[model samples]
Target: MIEVQCQCHGRLNELLPPSRRHRPFTHRLKQVMSLQQLLIPLRVPHPEVDLALINGDSVPLSRNIRNGDRIHLYPDTGDLDDPSLVLLRARPLQRPRFILDVHLGRLARRLRLLGLDTWYRNHMDDRPIIRLARLQGRTILTRDRGLLQQPEVTHGYYMRATSPDRQLHEFLARFEPWPWLNPFSRCSRCNGLIERLPESEVRRRVPPRLYLEFRDFFRCSCCDQIYWQGSHYERLRRYIDRLGV
Candidate 1:
């Protein structure tokens, strides 16, 4: 049997419940294993995006772990300024795009409402989700720990919050998507680009009263869904104000 000392720093521990948040814990293994293997039993999701130090030296997830080794893990820029530190994941996306699992539909729509590129379908299974994420270089945002635990999901996160509002708050804090925020720019239903449409084009599509009341109109390029500034716009504006972006 092999025994190793492991510790998680920064907000990494916050991802777990209080009962499992203990740091500097001892992990015992029946045989020598890779660093990824060690993280499996500890419920560390998407370890590729994290930094791992072994006995004061940085190493890859595939690095073989031995008995009595001391390991420390950090998430999202924690202790990353060290000159000798090594990064396990690839470069960050120039513009963040996300593919959410089945449970994050509300969050996905909210993200799209902010003009973020978000792909979501209620009927999508895990296999296709991972496959699409891999192909498009999109990050996977999921509430399922098991989905994030998949080795193929290199860029991913496990949302700890249950409610959609809290989940958005948590995501904003973690990813800091403020730089890319563009409100009312995408189709909330189909995740397609939205463009301003001439009033004459949408005159027949909308109610006569609405057409007379609202001068500005928009339509989704892919889905052709019409949008206008109305009562819902005020509520949406208020909600965006609450986000503090």
Candidate 2:
């Protein structure tokens, strides 16, 4: 038999039986079971867990549970003190760049607006998303549990929030991007770098009224798309400002 308990973060508490949440309850263990086996079925993947302790000792996801063992799980809180458990973390990244799933176009746009490198396509399929993510050292962002559970995915995030606003807040809270955020620096449409373009250079390219009314202009490095500080720009700036350190 095994006793399972989970931390408050990751919404894992919701998935557990109410009486079992934040507390342990014995369950029959027919055979040895790994941490992945227990949590994956509960919809919490390896990417979301900070640490796992078995029998009051830090253990990895591959650690097998024996009869009469106790288990505890924590979210990515960075408080783990055991040196051995540190290796249990899939791997740390040099930096966080992303490849988002088809349904996350709005979230992709928001991430790119903060100058975070995010690859997104409305028509892209999972195979290609996985391929590009692996080849480019990018993290896969999806709402697909099966995809996140795949063995090949070294880094991924499963979006729990349905609304884009809440999703962004959740993501920002996790990544703590206040230091990295660079607003109005990427194409909201194409995820391309935006740089200042002289007014005279685009004088004839823009509407005459816009050319006269707007002095600040930027162009996308990848798509040659143009941008000016319009209402959308102001709104996004306000959104970024709302995220304080």
Best by TM-score: 1
lDDT of 2 by residue, 161-222 (tens): 88898889978876776766787788888888898887677876788898888888879988
lDDT of 1 by residue, 75-120 (tens): 8665448767678766787779999999999999999999899999
Best by lDDT: 1
Each candidate: what lDDT?
0.86, 0.76
Q: Give me the overall lDDT of model 1.
A: 0.86
